[model samples]
Target: MLLQVEPMIPALRRYARALLRDTSAADDLVQDCLERVITYWNSRRNNDDTRSWVFAILHNLAMTALRKYAGTQGMHVAIDDVAESQMVARATQEDALHYRDLMSALDALPAEQRSVLLLVSVEDMSYADVARVLDIPIGTVMSRLSRAREKLLRITAAGVPAAAPMSVLRRVK
Candidate 1:
């Protein structure tokens, strides 16, 4: 089980980081998720997909944390302050700008839509899996994904920075 779960850590971290927008907090969340997975491993149905079950645990934990912190202000860190070594690769100037714009657009989306988008597009989860993870109907998953994509296209096409203000960050919770 540990060996099976080891390969999922990177994807879990990425999803957590995208959801929380804070590296340390995301790492903490992933840790908590893994702990819960280990504790409850035997309780899971034999036929259930482990990936979806793990993601569901993570999503539930993120939602709980977001709610817990909704009314409080936390320390804010600028992206430029992050160490260069932490980046996966050196991006060209154009790629960096494009990636920034894309992330900003993603951040502008409602949490529901963004969650659906990331799970489907970035994590490569099937709609059925995403629906299971999110406890939403498959049709709802498809609709939210469609809306997220359309919104992203419109934001990128406008060539305007869509990053929400820091004061509004908690609204995504």
Candidate 2:
């Protein structure tokens, strides 16, 4: 059981970090989720998808923490400051700017849509799996993903230069 779950740690960490945005907080959440899973490992159904099961556990824990923190302190994004040297070494100016724009667009999305988008795009989870993880209907997952994509594209496009004019095609029977 431990061996099976060990391989999934990196994925859980990535998901947690994406959701929390703070490395320490994401680590704590993953730890807590792992603990909970270990406690109930025997009770889990044999036929269940272990990856999805663990992901669901992590998602629930994250939601609970968010709710508790929201009531006490209100919700907000926590930005991590990077050292100038490290930043320069990571990416070129254009790449950095594009990454910043993408992150901004992702951050601007509603929590529901953001969750669905990350689960699908980042984690490569199927719509059905995302729906199960988020406890939403599959159709809702589709809707949120669609809206999130449209919003992200619109947001990012604002920074790009307009394309050259193109002729419109019309069909007449």
Candidate 3:
């Protein structure tokens, strides 16, 4: 069981980091997830994929944390909290700007959409696996992923709709 879970650590960390946007918090969540998996290992169905099972554990823990945090201060990602090295290593100003924009867009996403997006795009999990991990239908996972992509595009587009001028409508008497 340890060997099976070891190979998935890096991917799990990446997904966790994307969700929490804080390295230490992400690590803590991962640790909690691993502990939960070990504690419940015997109860899990044998036919289930261990990888998906572990991921499901992690996702549940993240959701719980989000809820806890939301009750206190609302869930949010601190883009500025990211490591300085990561922010400074971009090859050019344009790349840095784009990266920041993408991160902002991701941070702006609702938790459900963000979770599905990261599981699919960052962890490279199949849609079916993501659905299992998130405990949603596969079609719902696809829909969330699609909406996430569209929102990101709109956020990064040349003209963000939110920033556009509002037109005044005059009513004829």
Could you tell me how far off, in angstroms, the CA of residue 43 lies in candidate 1 after the best superposition? 0.9
Model 3, position 62: C-alpha lDDT score: 82
Ordering by TM-score = 1, 3, 2
Pairs with steric clashes in candidate 2: none
Could you tell me the lDDT of residue 65 within candidate 1? 88
Off by over 4 Å in 3: 71-95, 159-173
Q: Can you give the lDDT of residue 60 in candidate 2?
A: 93
In terms of TM-score, the best-performing candidate is 1
Best of the candidates, lDDT: 1
TM-score of 1: 0.82
lDDT of candidates 1 onward, in order:
0.92, 0.84, 0.84
Structural similarity to truth (TM-score) of each candidate: 0.82, 0.77, 0.78
Question: Between candidates 2 and 3, which one is better according to lDDT?
Answer: 2
Write down the TM-score for model 3. Answer: 0.78
Instruction: Point out where model 1 deviates above 4 Å.
Output: 76-96, 164-173
lDDT of 3 by residue, 97-172 (tens): 6666677778778889999998888888999999889889999999999999998887778443333344989999
Clashes (backbone N, CA, C under 3 Å), per candidate, total 0, 0, 0
